[model samples]
Target: MKFSPLLAELINALTCLPGVGNKSAQRMAFHLLERNREGALSLSNVLHNAMEHITHCQRCRTFTEDEVCEICRHPEREASGLLCIVESPQDVLAIEQTLSYKGQYFVLMGHLSPIDGIGPDEIGLDKLESRLQEGRISEVILATNPTVEGEATAHYIAQLCANASVDASRIAHGVPVGGELEYIDGNTLTHAFSGRRKV
Candidate 1:
C-alpha cells in the first residue's frame, strides 16, 4: 500500500484514463516499472507529442495536428453536402468503422448541459453556426448520443439548422435509447445512420 512518491504519482496519473481505477492504475504502473519501461517511455513520448500538437480542426472542430483535419480538407466531403454532427471524436471513429458514411463531421467535444454551465458557445455552437451559414452543407445529421442531454443537444442543433434553412435529421432505428455511439455495434451504427429521420 505504501508506494514511493514517484510510483504513487504514476498511479494517480494513470487513473486519469477513463475506467482506470486506483487498483488498475497501480497494476499498470507496476507493470510498466517492472516489465515494460521501454513501452511506457514510448507511451509517454506519444502522449506528450499528442498533447503538444493535437488541436481542433478549424472547420469542423475535430482533433487534428494540422490546421484542418483530413476529413475537412477532403473536397468530396464538401461536395456531398452532408454533415454528421457527433459529441466526440470517438463517435467519428465509430461511424467511420461502419464504412456507411462519407460526409463531413462537426464534433461538439461535449453535449449541452445547462446545469453544468455548458451552453451553445461552450460546445462551439457559434463556430457551428458560422459553418452552417457557409451553406456548403445541405443536410445536418444529428448523431448525438441518445441520453437526455444528448437529445437536448440534438434538438438545439436541429433548431439552428432549421433557422439556417438546412435539412436536419436524427439517427435512429438500431441504436437503442440512451446508447452511446462510441459503444454501439457497427451494424447498429450503420442502420441508425441509414435510417436517419427528419428532425
Candidate 2:
C-alpha cells in the first residue's frame, strides 16, 4: 500500500497543477512511469526550459520569452490603438481564436480579490494606467469574466479610463454569468466582442 519515495514525489509534484487532485496525479505518475517515459521526459524538459525562460511581457503582461509578447510586437496590432483588457492570458487566446478582435491587449493575470489580498497593484493596474495615459490606446474593451470579481475589476478599470479621458467599453453579456472566456465558444465570443457597448 506504500508508494516508493520517487513515485510519491512524482505524484505530489503533479498535484501542484490546477484542478489536478491526488488521484489524478497518481494516475498521471503511473502512466508516465509505465507507458510513456519518453513523453514524460520531453514534458519535463519543456517545463524546465519554459520556467527558466518565460516571463511576463513588459507591455501586456502576457507570458513570453522576449521583453514583449508577439501580439504586442506585431506592427498591425499596435497600430489599431484599441486595447482589450482581460483577466488572464487564456481569455486573450480565446478571443484571438475567434479572429473577432484586431487590437492590443493588457492582461491583468487575475481578478481583484480583496479578501485574498489581491489589489489593483497586485493585478498590474498601475502599468495599465500608465499605458492609458500614454494616449496611444483609443478604446479599452473590458473582456473580463462575468464573475463578481471580474465585474469589480472591470468597473475599476472603467473608472480609470474615465479619469484619463479614454473611451471604455464592456463586452456584451452573451457570455453566461459566472462563466470564463476560455469556456465560451468562438461564435459566442465573437458576438460578445462585437456587441460591446460603452461603459
Candidate 3:
C-alpha cells in the first residue's frame, strides 16, 4: 500500500538519521501514527527547538544556549593548566561521562582530512592557536580518535604546539586501534586520559 505524501516525507526524514533504514522508518511512522501522534509532535518540537537554540560555545566550542557552555562557565571546573582536545562535542561528553577529567577542553569540530580538503583552519585550529597563546593552558591532551585522519590531526597539532613551545600530549593506549573516543567505554577513556604521554 502506498503511504500518503506527508507520511512518506516524514518517514524519509526519519530514515535520514544514522542507523535508521527505510524499513525502520516505515515502522516508526506506522507506530507513531497508530499509537501516539502527540509523541511524534513532541519529538518534532524538541528537534526544532534544539536546532534553533543550541550553538557552539565561544570558549570551548561545545554546543550551548548562551555564549559559553556550562563547562566553560562553571567556576568549579579546573580553569587553568589543562586542555583536552577532541574532534566533536560528543567526544567531550563521552570523556565527561568518565568523570576523570576536570579540566578545560578545545573542540576541533572536525578532524584534519587532507583527502577531503579539510585543513586546520577549517577545523578551528587557528582559534586554538590563539587560545594557546593566552598563556592559561599548561598541557594539551590530543584526544582525537585512532583513525588515520585522527592520528594525522593529532600529530599536526602536536607539531604546532611544539613550535610554539606549548606542552602537548596524546591520550594513551587504552583506546583500541581504529576506535573512536565516542565508542570507548568510560573506564578505558579515563585510563587513556590519565596515562596520556608526550607526543
Candidate 4:
C-alpha cells in the first residue's frame, strides 16, 4: 500500500483547499486521475492564471486585475449617495447575481476577529474611511453576514463611518439570522439590499 511521491504530493496539494480533508483530498485526486487528465490540467492552469491576475482592488478590496473593479469603474452604476459593503468577494458575487443593486461595493475581505489577531486596520477599515472622506457617497449599506463576528464588524464600520459624517445602515431583514450571505438566494439578497435599515 505504498503510493508514488507524485500521487502523495497531489493529495497534499488538494488538501490545501478549505474544508478538503485528507480523505476528501485523496478521493478527489483519485477521481480526477481516473476520469480525465485534461480536467486536472485545466484546473491547474486556471488556478495558476487566476492567482497571477486576481488582486485586491485599490478602492474596494474586491478582486480585480485593474486598480478599480468593474463595479467601481462603471459609469452606469450610481456614482453618488450609494455604497454596499460586504465581507468578501464571494458575498459581492452573491449580491451581483441578484441584479438588483446598481451601486458601488466595498469588500472588507474579512471580519473583525480579535482572538485571531485580526483588527480594523488589518481588515482595511482605514482605507474605507479615506474613501468615505472623498465626499460623494451619502448612504452606505453594510452587507456583512449575520454571524456574530460579521455583525460586530458591521457595527464597527458603521460607527466609524458615522463618526466621519457618512450615513450608514445594515442589510435589511430577509437574510436569515446566523446565516451567511453566500448561501442566500438571489431574490433574497436583492430584497435585503433594497430594504436595508439605517443603523
Worst ten in a row by lDDT for model 1: 171-180
Off by over 4 Å in 4: 174-199
Model 1 stretches astray by more than 4 angstroms: 174-199
What lDDT would candidate 2 get against the real structure?
A: 0.94
- Name every residue pair that clashes in candidate 1: none
Residue-by-residue lDDT tens digits, candidate 1, 67-170: 98999899988899999999999999999999999999999999999999999998999999988999888999999997889989999999999899999999
lDDT at 93, model 2: 91
Model 2: residues with Cα > 4 Å off, grouped in runs: 174-199
Question: Per-prediction TM-score, please?
Answer: 0.82, 0.83, 0.82, 0.81
Highest lDDT: which candidate?
2
In the predicted model 2, the residue pairs found to clash are: none
> Of the candidates shown, which would achieve the greatest TM-score relative to the real structure?
2
Deviation in angstroms for 195 in model 2?
A: 9.2
How do the residues 50-169 of candidate 2 rate in per-residue lDDT, one tens digit apiece? Answer: 999999999999999999889999999999999999988999999999998999999999999999999999999999999999999999999999788999999999999999999999
**Model with the higher TM-score, candidate 2 or 4:** 2
